[model samples]
Target: MNPSNQSPNHTAEDESQAVVTRRIQRLSLHLMAISAQNYDLCIVSCSSRGKLEVDKAQLSRYMRGKHREIQERVFEYFNSRPDLQTPVEILKDDHRELCWRQLLGLVREAGIKPFKYVAEDPAQYFAIAEAVGSVDMSLGIKMGVQYSLWGGSVINLGTKKHRDKYYDGIDNLDYPGCFAMTELHHGSNVQGLQTVATFDPIKDEFIINTPNDGAIKWWIGNAAVHGKFATVFAKLMLPTHDSKGYSDMGVHAFIVPIRDMKTHQTLPGIEIHDCGHKVGLNGVDNGALRFCSVRIPRDNLLNRFGDVSRDGKYTSSLPTINKRFAATLGELVGGRVGLAYSSVGVLKIAATIAIRYSLLRQQFGPPRKPEVSILDYQSQQHKLMPMLASTYAFHFATANLVEKYSEMKKTHDEQLVGDVHALSAGLKSYVTSYTAKSLSVCREACGGHGYAAVNRFGSLRNDHDIFQTFEGDNTVLLQQVAGDLLKQYKEKFQGGPLTVTWNYLRESMNAYLSQPNPVTARWEGEEHLRDPKFQLDAFRYRTSRLLQSVAVRLRKHSKTLGSFGAWNRCLNHLLTLAESHIESVILAKFIEAVQNCPDPSSRAALKLVCDLYALNRIWNDIGTYRNVDYVAPNKAKAIHKLTEYLSFQVRNIAGELIDAFDLPDYVTRAPIARQSDAYAYYTQIVGF
Candidate 1:
């Protein structure tokens, strides 16, 4: 049967394609709508329903003509908001709540709904967001809960039947739940979890219990207040076997209900506590949980990938227990993607604030003389423009990554899975960490007023910092990617041709021994980095070589020490290598996407931004690139010139830069970002 003809509930190829296409269209429209509302600094553009004629031609021109104009339009749009004109103090307390509320309103107003069971109807959930043209699911999920009045639910990865039975309920939000895995003392180490689930064959139940205080689940979102059910991970044991015979059969997942809806109280043997007042994401209601001899039906065991029979026989689809655990850990890739998208959203907000403020606020000129916009200053440009460039780089990379994620979801191939996992881990680490750091830099660029709550920069920075830790700690995530690279390196050298290994050995040695090459003095105006074919090849080669070198070293090192020992010994270096590799990929992806864009001006500006991004990295890692012959001394000079040129070009387009973000007025209305016209009105009202 044609996949398209299949029911929306089933896997249909045609349906998937249609869904993807529609999403692209919706996203384009949303971008266009935002562009129209933000084109002029004087007019306020609010809701999606606002009647504004988006000049496709002008937009096309802006995209093709000059990069700075794109920056300018973005700033101009953000500058029109009055609420953005308010101080930060008044905004912080309400920021999360307001964002949450606005998101909920958007869902209802747009008639969009979230899937009740994400695992079962993941496509539906993906489609809804694609249709809305927003990637931040946190807002959508929060709103979906309020509109549906259905509590959140958890998806089981252990068994297919578990998914079949409970997934529908979850997809509909009929039973909102939490996935409980991490123990208080054994985070990221699933094999070390102490919570146990012993089979009671006679009773056909599994007795779940936390053996000690350390066995209690911590950092479980929706556990403290919202969740009624949980997909609990526990160590499986058989009590009938003598003292020495009770073996830990690795971590297993079971669907267990924790609270009774009627009384709104914890069920027997279940305890929960709120994690109260976090640094951010307060709306999530995170908390800890414990189970004392909680009995659940044997059928509750989530055994899609592994299972236990009612008679107490254990079985698994995969032979290796570690692989099973790894499979479960892989589920967090979705969260990582979500995190990357959120980082982009936060970056957009930061860029909007910085760019708008740069264009609107002026200082340090003669009295009664026309003051220059702060953006015109080389110092200010250096501070915010690189970040602006980063925003575009992040945007392009995220879009491509998300598309790849969806494609991989279709086949469930292990290689695809591993790739997605690796990429997500790296991108999440890079984007969140950089966004957090860059947002603060942008805030500082705005001076004391930037610290004022009215500017939104401080709040945005705080909100984004959580991204670095959530899903997975950025440090830990990079380690995982590095580990994967190391594993690949070992495989390539161990059983493969010596030629491959030799090539890698040669490159690594060259990198270690080579001196800096003279920098290229080629001047192609601001479009040097925009040379479509050249940028593409450069990025591709750099990324491929970086990964190859790291993989080769990891492989070679494993020969001297055991896998685990080698990983531990070279851990720091691996992390550094992983970061370098990820950054290369990001730059490459950004350059690729921008070069392919139809607009010449947008391409040129994007090129400048790309150059800045690359140059900044080159400057930071001058020694490494110099040693490898990747960057010559003369090329270093080019890097500096590119940076200066980009800063200059971006200064003029500060207004337009903010426009590209397409934020509504309500979100950007902080006081310092307001335009001259609005400032006049505001000052008049204050009788200044």
Candidate 2:
């Protein structure tokens, strides 16, 4: 009867409906088969004998580090505004629109004038961005592109006139913009960027041009939809004094209007292309841009470090083009600092979810007994506890970086700028890469439940994966760190005073060169392994030794391989040294934090976590310690045993440790991350 009544289109429509019906039936059975497991019986059966006695809120405050109040304020603001939250299931364009709306709501309602804090209080600025990141990374980055990259460029790189002209609009989101630095072909190598800005002396204008497809600006946040202008970096070409041609005056930034504000249309000679769908962070509209003789007033150039006159004369306070480039980049160190903080936040969320779920989801047990919490299992503890310790360690380290950067801003110390830049580069690279990898570890640790998108491991992993490449690629950043280390190493031997970070280098190098004391090397006591002094000394030795070894290798190879070839040969060694130095810096910061903790209970608990962090790192690289005979076989074994023992100790306090992160249900948006009643929450959200 259906066939007889069916029209030509009706037959196809029915066939389509039949296919959908069959697919839905199959999916319904699959959901039933793999529905989230209920934790009611497990929760009831679990014993609570091993909970830590630390003050949870105090630990949270300590973990939040500096600008705790600002972070909390942001959290409260976001929590109260349910309308700002985007649904999990939406198209990319919708997600981008919602993210933009959230940004507008934040400015209009939350009064988060990030531009104000960028200069007056960068720590607060970073804290606000980190908090936004905890809610949604896309919003965090969009805010960054608007306030930090664009507005920060105006404030940091531009003159007072440029600031007066652009600051208000940028701060209020009236002129949403892009940080158009990276080009399609020149991502890490700014010196090679082909985009040119030629000054027109007669008209007093700079004509920006994209020489070819390769010169097009790429991966620019906010460029596709919202950005009206960009702080475009291009090779400055000033008209020659001889009246012959233009002189290449190196890379400089200029404010170029990309879209008409009232019409919301692409401006003439400025092309904008959507980057289309990405692996994640689809909420931010990333796009490519091309400039074909885009003309702007001569005053549009950000003239803090460098400037061009109305007559096409180029001037810079920095002595050389290299110095100018360095200064320009140094002013933007906040990006790396913010990313490091956000990466840590993401890691905290992942660790909290995985650890909490591990405690709730019970698995194998002996006969005639209640099943054990998965966290009770050694394998799970090994996976989650160390990450928990690292989260704390990175938190303290990033806080230190923020402090150093803030101090640099206040003092305007050239040394501090270099130090902040190097540290930011290293920490951003190290922490983001670690968090990127650890997301998967956390995902796997939670078993199949973590695979579900609602749990956030998938999106978190995909979104944070770029942290290794963007801002600065990890490899290049590490190389920069190594290069700086070598410069310091040379200075140390030449009787130059070392910076605060490198002061220990001389002593550590001396200690490494002298000898490995038999008594220290063979010391296997728990107290000895846990000693902050001993842990720091071991870390210092590793870094100093690596520095010396890499330096020697580079020098030896340069004789035969040439400088660039030698560097290529020693790239792996340089990376190791960079990582070792960054780790040592992080470990020292964690130790200082623990020592300074006023609460005895919190301090003791933190010491346990610190020991785990240090020993776990040492154990992971036991071969390095063993190769130099810095630790005896027995000592290495003891370190390994203590690592396991500390994991067990941390496992007992796992819930508290994660609870200290203080991510509310709204921020986590995962049913299993609930502090209490995760089972009921999981079933309710999954609707099974």
Measured by TM-score, the strongest candidate is 2
lDDT by residue for model 1 over 78-195, one digit each (tens)? 2443342323343333444554444444434333345442343443443343222222223433433322222222342544555466655554445657768778898766788999
Q: Compared to the true structure, candidate 2 yields what TM-score? A: 0.92
Global lDDT of model 1: 0.63
Model 2 segments more than 4 A misplaced: 1-52, 241-244
Error of 2 at 326 (Å): 0.9
lDDT of each: 0.63, 0.89
Q: How close is candidate 1 to the true structure, as a TM-score?
A: 0.76
Q: Which stretches of candidate 1 lie over 4 Å from their true place?
A: 1-110, 116-172, 239-243, 366-368, 493-566, 674-688
Judge candidate 1 at residue 227 and give its lDDT.
76
> How far off is model 1, as Cα RMSD?
19.0
The candidate scoring highest on lDDT is: 2
Clash count, predicted structure 2: 0
Please report, as a residue range, the 10-residue window in candidate 1 with the lowest summed lDDT: 40-49
Error of 2 at 98 (Å): 0.2
